[model samples]
Target: MTISANLALAYPEIILAVGALALLVLGAFMPKQTSLVATGGVAVLLAAAVASATQPFGVAFGGGLIADAAATFAKVAIYVASAVAIPLGQPWFERRGVKTFEFPVLILLSALGMGMMASSGDLISLYVGVELSSLALYVLAAMHRDNAKASEAGLKYFVLGALSSGLLLYGASLVYGFAGSTLYADIAKAAGAEANTGLLFGLIFVICGLAFKVSAAPFHMWTPDVYEGAPTPVVAFFAAAPKLAAMMLFARVLADGFTDAVAQWQQVLVALALISVAVGAFGGLVQKNLKRLWAYSSIANIGYAVLGLASGTSEGVQAMLVFMILYMVDVTGFFACLAALSRQGKAMETIDDMAGLVKERRGLALAMTVFSLSALGLPPFSGFWAKYVVFKAAIDAGLWGPAVIGLVGSVVAAFYYLRLIKVMWFDGSAGATDKPPMEAKAIGLTAAVFAFPVVLVAITWLNPLAARAAQALGLA
Candidate 1:
């Protein structure tokens, strides 16, 4: 491809990269321009979304990046999620008497990196994308510098994230050495012809590193703390966009680069899925902190998504894409509800803090209820359909044993969601929470409506779109 054509293929990423730098400069030179910077950041993301939707599909950057249906789908979602997050942080920081334009800029940069990840066509690009996103997240985790827990969260994430990066780089080197190239197409050709022990080892290490990014079990120690300590708005973004980006990158690396070795990687994914489901289901039962509980909830949900990937079929990938999109809505809305509520100027962090929420803030309580039910996979809610398709995909791929275990895990996870709902509606008043911010309330209620009636309509289009994106993975 010509240089101009490659640049055109990367228009969405260019918008984000250039816009972030512009916003950063504007914020530095201009005083008290946080709100303007934030607004600008959202505009940039929306522009990128439009660019992503319109970009033609093709290999670019010497096959180091790809603009395909899957990349377009993921990039648009990542941009929208990041856009929502910018407004969310503005009100949150204002309440605490802290004002900085860096938050939105960092989110923009992170979204830029995530866009790269979704489009990555080679190991080098994958590593670059991962680091770009991770560095911004490390800073964001500790954006509340005055808070000890926030600092601690940032430190832990940085340390563990660095370790994962090391593993990734080492694996990438090994893969390069064994396959004689870093491009996924090259690796796929090499693996298809003859799967070697060295290449498989490298693949295993790479999976471990990506698994950490998704907060799958055994590497999930940082999630609960980070979610509990980071600003709620940041956590909302963390729970939604990055998860989908990492999973799409994961699907691409495996499905596009290692399809011939499905038998090898499928076993590894199966183990991660079952372990994550078990830990997320049982571990959450003992949590008192609401954020920590949701952290576990995210872990289990990722497990289900990973289960779909484990099936190693195009249908499985389609189910995974649909499931992640739906789950992102439910999770983001849940965190937004949390961000909206407070009691006596203190944030609500524990389960007991939500006691009798329906009495004081019926709208928030109702939104929370809808999100909880949808997350629990109850009938008529979006989460139910998400799980149904994932389970169906697994069964169709002849993964009945893992599918059954995943179903049981969902049943076990129900207790925590039900407990949360019960506390909100039935328990005695813990005292009225301050009136929620307009942005948080709007996002929460909108997500709730989507989780129900709108989802019924959404699936009509989402299902076919997801199938097309999955087909782009070339996983027959």
Candidate 2:
């Protein structure tokens, strides 16, 4: 490919990279202008999203990267999620005395990695993208240098993230050594023609690495601590966009690169899904900190998504996209609401803090209720549709046992969400204040806007977008 053509194929990533560097330099010279930097970063992301949408699909850089329909859709979703997360972080950053230009720049850089992951067609490029994103996230987690919790979260994430990356790199090396190529297409051809033991070992290791990235069970130990200790806005970002990018990569690596290895990977995916569902459902039941509860909730939700991918069919991919889109909205909204819930300028952190929340900030309270119910996969809500599509896909693929297990996990998870509602509506304040800080109204409004889809998704035109996403992946 010509230089211009490769640049065109990677236009969004180029824009993001340039924007991040500019923002970094600008922030250095004008330390007090961090907000402006953030605004500019968001505008850059929006522009990149548009560019990504308009770009033509094809292999670029000798098949190391691609700009296909699926990649475009996933890139756009990540951009939107990252954009939404920016403003939500503002209040927390200010309160923690951590407001700086680095935060937005890091997010943009991380997003660049996510975009690369979505577009990557080779193992080397995919590994590069994962590390770029993970490194940014590690810094973001520890942004509040003065906070012990933040420091701990960052250190733990860095350690575990590095370990996972090493595993992934080792797997890539094994695959390359055995198949004599790093391009997914070449690897696919090689694996399909011969059942090489080294290749099988490499595939399993790669799955393990990706599984850790998604916070799947047995590899999810870092999630609760990271989620609980990181700043709320950062946690919100952590819970949504990065996971979507990683999952998209997961689906692509399996469906596009290892299609012939379906029997080999399917059982592994099912086992991870089942274990995640069980752990997430039971783990949240005893949590006092709301963030920790949400962490466990995220784990279970990932299970539902993986179950969809376990089918290894276009319908399954479509179902996974549906589940993830709705999941993103609910998770982002829930955290936005939590970010808005402040008493005497400090953000609320526990179930008790939510006591009598309905009496004041009714809008936030109601949004929270809807989001909680949606997270539980209740009917008439988008979350219900999300789970339904995935569950149906699993059953259709003759995985009735996994489907039933998912349904049971949903039922168990509903208890904690209901408990949150009960505390907000029926319990006493127990000395916690109810008034949201003056800065929180915007966060509350953001939460409300996202909450709309939770109830209206079934009736709204958004249903078609899910179909479009399916088509993007050639699944519809």
Candidate 3:
């Protein structure tokens, strides 16, 4: 592809790359104020998002990148999530005396990876995007260098990530050997002509790689350890936009490129979905750390997300998109509250730490309650509707068993979420409470700003933009 064509198609990534570099350099000269760094980073990302929205290449770079509705919509959601997360991290960064510039640059770099992954039209480009994103995260996870746990988490993630990357490359090689192309649309065409061992082996390896990224069960061993060890903001990042991007890529590849091999990959995805749901729902029960709990929650949520892909339809993808946005809002809100609860540079880790939180910080505790409930799929919340859409899609596709299992998983998942609530509401007796610190207020305000509207978007069916974006992306 010509440079102009590539730039036109992936202008957002280009802008983001520049933004990351600018933040890296200017951030060094700028004052150490974290708020300034965060807001600056957010402004740059928002600008890139706006530019991407207006750009109309449609498909550029010889189909190596796509600029359709799906990619655009995912970018929009990612930007919004980053916007929400930036302020949420301000206090956390300041508390730890971390470098402001590095934080925002890492965030931008991660977003760049997500943007490229969303637009990638070929397997090679997709791997590049995933690696770019993952590398940023590995550093971010261990940014707390003084903390031994954080360093260990980063090391574990890097090692496992290397294995996953190798598996993915081997799979891609097998797929290309069988199909004669790595471009998704071309591979889809090639795979439809015949069935063979090479195709199955390639797809199986590919699924295995993606499964690890998405934290599917049997491959999710890293999650709880990583989440527990990483900084809370870093953990929050994992639970939000990055999860959405990776899962979306998983769905897109399977639904678009491997559509012809639905039967073969579907079995793998279904088994993965079931196992993840089981592990995520149950594995969180014994967690002492809130971050670890959310890690398992993420695993289960991806199970719900993957259900859409197993349906093998555009409607399924649409439902998955909606589910992802909803998941992002709720998860982000929870972490915001978690960040808010931290005092004296100490984060809230155990459920007991939240004892009498409602009494301590009324507005924030209430907001956290709402977020937790929504995540559990309770009525009148965004999460309820997110799961509702996916559940309905599964039913329509006649995957009633998985749908029912998902509902059951939701209920089990509710146990830990409610455990959080119970600690805040009923489990602990009321006591004299201290007013939350300034940092807590900032994080609370940030989360509340985005979360309430997200819930309204679910209950009222009011947002045409999301639906339109989904449609444009060939989702429904």
Candidate 4:
């Protein structure tokens, strides 16, 4: 491809990268314009989404990056989710009497990196994208630097994230050593021909590293602590966009670069999925803190997505994409509900803290109930469809045993979701929470409506779009 054509193909990333730098400069010069910076950040993200949707599909940067339907699909989700996260943080920080422009800038930069991750065509680009996003997240985790728990969360995330990066890099080196190239197309060619021990060894390590990014067990030790300790809005962001980006990258690496080794990777993914589902379902049963519980919820959810990917079919990829996007909405809405509620000027962090929430904050409670039900994969909700497509894909690919285990895990996980609903509607009042910020309330309610009515209409279009995107992966 010509230089101009490659640059044209990279329009979405260029928008984000340039926009983030500009926002940073604006924030530095106009210190008090935090809200303005946030609004601008959202605008920039939306612009990138447009660019992503319209960009020509092709390999770019000499096969280091790609602009394709799958990349476009993932990038649009990441951009929109990051945009929603910005308004959420502004009110949250304002309530805490902290005003800083850096939050939006960090989010923008993080989204930029996630976009790179989705488009990455080679190991070097993958590492760059992962590190860029991870570094921003490390800073975001401790945005509330004065809070001890926030500081701890940031420190832990940084240390663990670094370790995962090391694993990824080492694996990349091994793949390069064995395959004699870093480009994914080249790696696929090499793996297809020989399927050697060294390549397989490196692939396992690479899976381990990406698994950490999605918070899949037994590498999920950091999720609960980090979610519990970080700002609620930040946790909401964490639970949504980044997970999708990592999983897309994961699917690309496996489906595009290692299709010939499916027999090997499939077993590893199944083991990871089963372990994650078991841990997420059983581990969440005893949690008191809502964030911690949701942390486990996310782990299990990622497992479901991975299950679909393990099927190694285009239908599986489509199913995974659909599930992740729907799950992202549910999780973001759940955390938005959490961020919207408070008790006597303090944030509500526990299941008990939400007792009789329906009595005082009926709208918030209703939205929470909708999200909870949807999360439990109940009928007529988005999450049910999310699980259905995944399980269906698994079964069609002769993964019935794993699918049954996943279904059982869903049943077990329903207990926590039901407990939340019961507490909100039936338990005695914990007293009225502080009036919620309008932005958070709007996001929660909007997501609830989407989870139900909007999703009914959405799935009609979403299914075909996802299938088309999956076809772009060149998967069978």
Comparing 2 and 4 on TM-score, the stronger one: 4
**lDDT of model 4 at position 436:** 93
RMSD of 2: 1.8
Q: Look at candidate 1 and tell me the lDDT of residue 135.
A: 97
Off by over 4 Å in 2: 432-476
On a 0 to 1 TM-score scale, where does candidate 2 land against the true structure? 0.96
What TM-score would each prediction reach against the true structure? Answer: 0.99, 0.96, 0.93, 0.99
TM accuracy, model 1 = 0.99
Residues 319-416, candidate 1: write the lDDT tens digits: 99999999999999989989999998999989999999999999999999999999899989999999999999999999999999999999999999
Q: For residues 1-476, could you state the per-residue lDDT of candidate 2 as single tens digits?
A: 89998899999999999999999999999999978988988898999999999999899999889898788888998998887777677556876677688888999999999999988899989999999999999999988889899999999999999899988899889989998999988988888998888998898889889989999998999999999999888998999899999998998788777878888889999999999999999999999999999999999999999999998777888788778878888888788778777787666899988998888767788888988988898876778888988999999999999999999999999999999999999987655554654444555556556555534644355456555655655222
Ranked by lDDT, the better of candidates 1 and 2 is 1
> Whose lDDT is higher: candidate 3's or candidate 4's?
4
Weakest 10 consecutive residues of candidate 1 by summed lDDT: 89-98
Instruction: Tell me which of candidates 2 and 3 scores higher on TM-score.
Output: 2
Residue 81, model 4, lDDT: 97
Q: Write the per-residue lDDT of candidate 3 for residues 1-476, one digit (tens) a residue.
A: 66887677777888889888877777778757556777788998898889778888567777778887778878877876776667666657666776556878888999999888888788888898899999998988888888999999999999998898898889989888988888988888887888777877998998898888878887888888998888876777888888888877886677667777877887777788888899999998998788888889989988988887677667677778888888887787677667666544466678878888876677878888888888888877778888888888788988899999988998988989988888888756445444455654666555665555546754455235445544554223
Clash count for candidate 1 is 0
Q: All predictions: root-mean-square deviation over Cα?
A: 0.7, 1.8, 2.4, 0.7
- Residue 466 lDDT in candidate 3: 48
